[model samples]
Target: MEPEAKWNGSTEQVEFSRMSPRSQGFTKLPGQKTCEKSVLLFTFVLLISVVLWGTLLFLFLTRFKKIAQDVEKLQESCVYHNDSGIVTIIRRLQVDQWDLKNDVPQLSKAVNKLQEDQTTLKSKASQISQQVDRLQEDGTTFRSQVLNEKNTATQALEKLQEEIEKLWTEFQRANGSVCKNCPKDWQLFQKKCYFFGNEPKTWPQAKFACINLQGRLVSIKNKEEQAFLTQKANKKGSWIGLRDLDMEGEFIWMDGSPLNYSNWSPGEPNNQGQGEDCVAMRANNGRWNDAFCRGQQEGWICEKLATC
Candidate 1:
């Protein structure tokens, strides 16, 4: 059989017979066969390349989508955890603020109480200071008054001493002029005179007799005076000037002087019988005793200052 060739668009087509030796020889040329085979191989390689590139692009797109979804889920989880932590912190801060608000008033009250106590202490201190000042003033006034009184008493004592000295001088002068010598029958000793009465009499009667004789019952001034009187009595008890007529247990001389010197016998002046107020000198030992004023009768002795 023979194949016909046609031309289209300025291209020519040739028909070749399989049984013809010329057509077969032309188709079997090496250059033409090689050209056809090369064309086929190139087309197949390009198609394969295009398919491989398309498949790689599709796989890349699918992987990118999956990775984006996983990242979005992780971001959501982080946001939720962060929100929970923030809420807890905010609640704790709110509770602490409430506690502070509750404590404020009590702290203020304590401060006010301290201030009141301080004010009261200051007032008390002021009052004490004023009282101390007044006490100091009074103490100063008292000390001044005591000083004045002491000075006045010292001056008065000096004046009284001077007056006493003057009176003593006048008494010495009078005694020298009035008593030149003792009277007859009266014994003299140490510028004084004494008379012993032999007649026994009551104490009061003896006191009056001595007064009438211008003398007092014998007041023994010292041991010498006492010894002199005791010797003159001549072994007889005699009433002395010593008596407690004004007060019990207090013997004073009839001359209104205190009895300074005493020669009392053992257990004497006992004021026996409750009425023994007059004092007498016992004859045996010249010691004194208390006797009844009017009930006992005894001899008497009188004494007067001697004349110059």
Candidate 2:
């Protein structure tokens, strides 16, 4: 409500009832002008909002089309690369298989050649072994043949020597003119002549008799000669050429031959009385006994190399 204006006796306040209330009020009214100004401001803001949303929608659709084209190109490129890789791998595998097939025949031929060489070597080795065996057998046979020939030659020589000795003995007996060969009474043995005297004599006399006969007192050589002299002994002891007079006990033969053999009667050479130094042969077994050189009279044997 408006306060009534004071009627203070002024000329402007002539009649209060005659004027309208709005005109009579002291404040001015803002009715139709304010409503028109508000409506114009709201319409301008709605037009600006619609223009901005439409611009954003057009930009979004353009970007989405570019992304879809890029995705399709990428898928095509991957498929092409996969096909190329598969073809390259297949070609390489085929080349390797062909190379392996070409080498197999050459390897087999090399193996066959090696086997043939091995067989040839084996055959040659067997031939060499057989030749060696045959050579060994021939050598053994040749050795045996040589031994047989040697034995045959030795036997023939022995027989021829015996016949020559017999012929020489006969020739001396017939001639009897101070023969250069053995005399008639002497016995012939291997390359030597031996004489056995009948009468007994002291050892000194026996030795001198043999020297006079152009020979030395006997020196026994081997068992065969011993047996021969034993046969000629006729159960009588005989003086032979062995003594130890020079050294007392070490006996030696007259011809300076080594005393390699002995046939002493057991306990015979005891050097009894130190006088028994000369050797005497026992007639029974051809074993020798030592006796005094000047004491006993014993038959004696003499020996010399034969003239033939």
Candidate 3:
């Protein structure tokens, strides 16, 4: 029994130690209530924070989109204003250019009127210049004609003076030195008488024959010359004053001057082609006639005036 009692005592001691509450209280008593409350509070705060952050982010995104739309509308209004202002400026400039073009026709008409007046003045000036040239030519011709007339008048006056002096000397010579021993075949001029019938020849041969006698052919210049020579010839058919040997059919005297008045027989100087080369005077009519040079039926007479 003693031995059984000891083993039982050891087993009771082991079980009593296991069944005591003091060991369990000591392990759980330090951390059990505080840990449970802290877990619960941290879970509630995480849920509230998530809800507030999500609401604020949604509001911010919505306001940003509205502000961007307002900016787009304002830019569109500004573009329309700029386009309308440019169109108004271009239309006003076109209206001003059209007004300037309307005045060009009046300027062109004014220029044309000035040109027409200039042309008319030039035509009148040309006509006036032509008239002035014609008047100058006429004045030159009139001056030349007046100079020629003055020279002719002076020559005529000197000729008249010489004839008056000759008549005075001739009257003094008449019957003062009368030729008592003169020949019958000689005629007197101033104080000298000449004989011309030394030979019968043609006009050329007669000229040479007269030069040998220191004489020339007869020359009559005035009406007193006709009476003086007729009375001196003593009624003979003699070769006398006028002929046409120098200019054909233009009768001239021996002094190389033309005859203003001629003493010719009627129907004389027929110039018949059969040697009508000699000049003869008619006895009764006291006029000249053309005769044959070979005919010896007519003779010649001559006279000479003093040069002094």
Candidate 4:
């Protein structure tokens, strides 16, 4: 049977038992479709909210772990055990910088003082070098002056000695001691006697003649003896005991004495004729001349010690 329908004031009403089986089933299908649509919309919204919450939880955990690690590093970097951060280390570094700044002026002053001392030492060294040079110069001058004075004093002493010798010779002669101490025709001077011979003979012949008389040819010792002999020769060329027969230009006496004193005439003893090995006192000035040993004949003088 078909369900009867009634019109209410604002809606139409159908009785459920009076409806046919196909119409009731059709009316129930519309209500069921609406309920299914509501359930599907609610499930989609819940799933979107769950996804958003899961992403937010993951981000929060990662950020918290990174912040903990940064705090641990800051703890390790602290300078003091009680310190929490880098502030104490920074303050100590600032104090060291201030100390270095304060010491700069003192270091500069010390360096400047060293430079001044170096300059003073260099100046003193230069002055000392100059003083040493001056002293050397003064010493050289003093040595030269001393040497000159010594030479002058030596020459004066030689002259004075010659004069004294001449005076002593004169005193002996004036005392008439010549005849008492010497041979008959011999002249005495200085404890020795000299014989002036008149015979003209060669040098060798005169030497032998003097030896036969127990005397040798005269060997004049000093200026005083030389003067006396020259006066006795009386401007005659006479042979003395001087000869260079053993070696040229080195005269030696016959009595084996050294020929210490010599009175050579200017430009004489020139070994004239190349065979002049014998010496003769010049008749003109009593200076010495070298003559031929065997070719020239000359007067001779003999000398011997007096009888005391």
Instruction: Give the higher-lDDT candidate: 2 or 3.
Output: 2
TM-score of 3: 0.35
Task: State the displacement of the C-alpha of residue 245, model 1, in Å, after optimal TM-score superposition.
Answer: 1.3
Q: Which ranges in model 4 have alpha carbons more than 4 Å from their true place?
A: 1-180
Question: Whole-model lDDT for model 2 versus the true structure?
Answer: 0.80
* Clash statistics: count for each candidate: 5, 0, 0, 1
* Deviating ranges (above 4 Å) for candidate 1: 1-180
lDDT per residue for candidate 4 within 1-308, as digits (tens), equals 22332344223434555668998688678778888999999998899889999889899999999999999887766545546445766778899989989999999999899999999999999999999999999999999999989957854674465356546656776775453377888888877888988888889899888877867788888999999998888466998889998888888876556789889999978997789998888896789888998955557899876653
lDDT of each: 0.79, 0.80, 0.64, 0.80
Give the alpha carbon lDDT tens digit for every residue of 1-308 in model 2. 23344444333556655678877564555766688888988888888888888888888888898899999988888678766796578788889889878988998898899999999999999999999999989989988898888857754664465457558766775776233456788888765889988787889899889878867788888899888889987477889999997788889887656688889999878999879999999877888889999965557899876773
Give candidate 4's error at residue 146 in angstroms. 57
**Candidate 1 clash pair list:** 179-307, 179-308, 180-307, 180-308, 181-307
Output the worst ten-in-a-row residue range by lDDT, candidate 2: 1-10
- Provide the lDDT at 1 for model 2: 22
How well does candidate 2 match the true structure in TM-score terms? Answer: 0.41
TM-scores for every candidate against the unseen true structure? 0.43, 0.41, 0.35, 0.41
TM-score of 4: 0.41
Which ranges of candidate 2 are over 4 A from the true structure? 1-181
Q: Would you list the clashing residue pairs of candidate 2?
A: none
